[model samples]
Target: MFGFGKKQDQPQSTIQSEFVEDVAPAAPQVTSVSSASTPSPLMSVSSITLPGAYLHPITKDNGIEYLFINENPMGVPAGKPKERMTGSFGPLPMRTNYDKLLYGTGAAYLTGFFGGGIYGAYRGLQIAQGNSFKIRYNSVLNSIGRHGPRISNSMGVLTMGWALLDNTIYSFRGVSDYYNHISAAFLAGAIFKSTAGVRPALIAGGLMTGVVGSYGLWEQFTSEKKETKIPSLAPAPAA
Candidate 1:
């Protein structure tokens, strides 16, 4: 009985010692993995770089200077300055849709005024050839007053419609080029003249399309030429 008891006690002690040894090795493995996964602060700081044309700010025992791309900074590319898009229509530089609308309205009003004046003058000449001077003047003034508001209302509606269509196409289809502008103008004119007559619709559409398209083309061509004459100088790429 004493020999059997000693054999059981010896096996139990050996098993506990083996279990402790296995757990000890696992602790060190876990610690090694944690240390390897940790990132160094110095490495993170050294990896950052300046973006775009902005020069990296150098802080040392010396001084500091804010350097820009075309301002002749050291180690920067030297060339002509870049041409930024003005997003303008003639003399009006539109920064928002509201600006565009306001300008469009004004342009429409001016066109209406000129058109009415021309029509009134033609009618006045016809009246002068048949009636007395007093009648001609009255007739001319009446004709001007009548045609002015009519032409203005029509033109205003057409301009607003064009703006709406242009904005819609740009928002949904991302098509805001010259062709898009011309198409929008033509479509707007057609829609405006739909109730008038077939001939009127065709005439209005053709006129609007030609005017807007030619203007856009001219602007684009001029801008391209200017850009070509002045090369754009960009800074080094950011990391």
Candidate 2:
């Protein structure tokens, strides 16, 4: 037998092999969010601003009134004024209620002028077709029949003219931008009254008209502001 291969033996370590233990990661501790840190219950509000005009609505929560700028947290009240939040457009001053009322009434008056003209036209037509005609024997009186219908028509014409004047003069564009025109309407009303015998009811009506017009205009200025606050999910604050 030929000694072709000889086997070699290797020495093993005397220290016994120690097994490594597996460890798990510690779980994160959850913390509760406070109510004060969460959002409030109020919903979306609106705000608007224009040249020399500031419009916004007041919303109160928990006995505190908040004045929003554009109806959003975009402009929050860092502090309150010394007197009170009377009127302000966000960080700017807002128009008074009187102004708002005046704007609203002006719009109504303008609309009524057109309505009145239509009514006057209808009345003129009715009067002109009257079956009962009175003819006076007097030559002067007999000649006035033609003028009676003409007078009614003239009144209708006057009403139509007034409607046109109101449309042109008191329109939103005119009143908002043209202060001179606004003054002119008031002055004309006053000046014409003295010679024509100013009617107290008409004056009162005009004031009411202006007030309504101002309110309507004020409403248009406000735009909605959306908020992400969810009041229901928020927890109560600790005392």
Candidate 3:
């Protein structure tokens, strides 16, 4: 009776097998980090690729700052979305010929001319040393008064005329190319100088043709270079 009551010891392997079989394997001990506990890595990051085509782009309306993008942002193509011209003030949109003429090109020329006048004045003062502060101030004022508004207004008029011609060419051809720039520039010079004389108009037109043609060629070369250049590899995230 005592021997029968005593239990027999099972093999260690059998015990192990029995234990594995008896317990349904616990669901995988999965570990997960909750989203609520951490901020996303992608938030508030700036993009270097496209300025206006990024997650959010600021816009300007009639010289006033407006925090807005296009109404249908997704409709915009990836490569280039019409936002504003580079180096343009206020980041104003240049979608139409009128917009470019009124604000972009004309405004740029005006600003540049005025800035040039100021810079020229400073340079003159340096060249003619020993002038007193009052003299220097007067000289700068005289230079600015003589050059800034006068030259800038003249350039603005010329730019407006050129823009009209360029847009006309673009509309007729249905293609944006250097030819439009060349033709429009020539016409603008010729028309503007036509007031003086026929010879002046021809000479002005010829000079403008050369300048615009050279610029267009340079633009083409640079664009090609940009296309051919290899993109740099992004760095791997830290562990």
Candidate 4:
């Protein structure tokens, strides 16, 4: 019999539908391709800061990274809990003015005392001019005994003046910088040489400033702290 009625067409349609379902095409999948010209920068600077020092990031061609320290950044250090008197005094950093006075003066005095003792001994040796061991020993002793106390006293005065000015500035400004040191040196020098005259006092101030500034720069250049490995807390790329 010829299939001519609408009912006869139903079987063909059902078979076509079933065939389509069984052999349906799959959805196209996508593959990602990198289009960037270069990878992300490896030299990432950190925001982590240190008091009284600048953290400068540098990356070497060898894939090593370093944090270079720039001391006495001559500006307010960045951080929270920023408070006055939060700076180093002599050999130590302090949170109060009292410590700056007490410890700073003591440390400076001791340093000067020992330093003067050595200088005095050398001076005594030169003064004796004799090659004799006994003469050298006596000269050294005499020189130290005579000049040591005076040198120590003078050092103490200078240290005290410096500490006073340094502490006052730090307390008022709440920052540690190269200027503070320079100013303190100037004031201390001016005061120490005040009796000499205005010209001598100015000269002394200039000399003191030069000496302090030179030493600070030299320390920065020669110190091992100039370059340090990136701190463990800093962000780093995964291995």
Per-candidate Cα lDDT values, in order, are 0.56, 0.34, 0.54, 0.57
Indicate whether candidate 1 or candidate 2 has the larger lDDT: 1
Model 3 per-residue lDDT at 67: 42
Worst 10 residues of 4 by lDDT: 47-56
Instruction: Give TM per candidate.
Output: 0.53, 0.23, 0.49, 0.50
RMSD of 4: 21.3
Off by over 4 Å in 2: 1-76, 82-106, 129-192, 197-239
lDDT of 2 at 16: 15
Error of 4 at 56 (Å): 38
- Cα distance off (Å), candidate 3, residue 101: 2.3
Tell me how candidate 2 scores on lDDT.
Answer: 0.34
Question: lDDT by residue for model 3 over 102-139, one digit each (tens)?
Answer: 66465658676868697668755765445688877777
Report the C-alpha displacement of residue 74, candidate 4, in angstroms: 33
- Distance from true location, Cα of 42 in model 3, Å: 48
- By summed lDDT, which 10 consecutive residues of candidate 2 come out lowest? 47-56
> Best candidate per TM-score, number?
1
Q: Tens digit of lDDT per residue, candidate 2, span 1-239?
A: 01111111222122111110101221221112233444334422211111110111122112234554543343443454222212333343334333323332443455455555455445444555344443212322333444444544443443333334344444544333223223434443444344555675357336534643464355446553212110011122222
Tell me the RMSD of model 3 versus the true structure. Answer: 19.8
Selected candidate, larger TM-score, 2 vs 4:
4
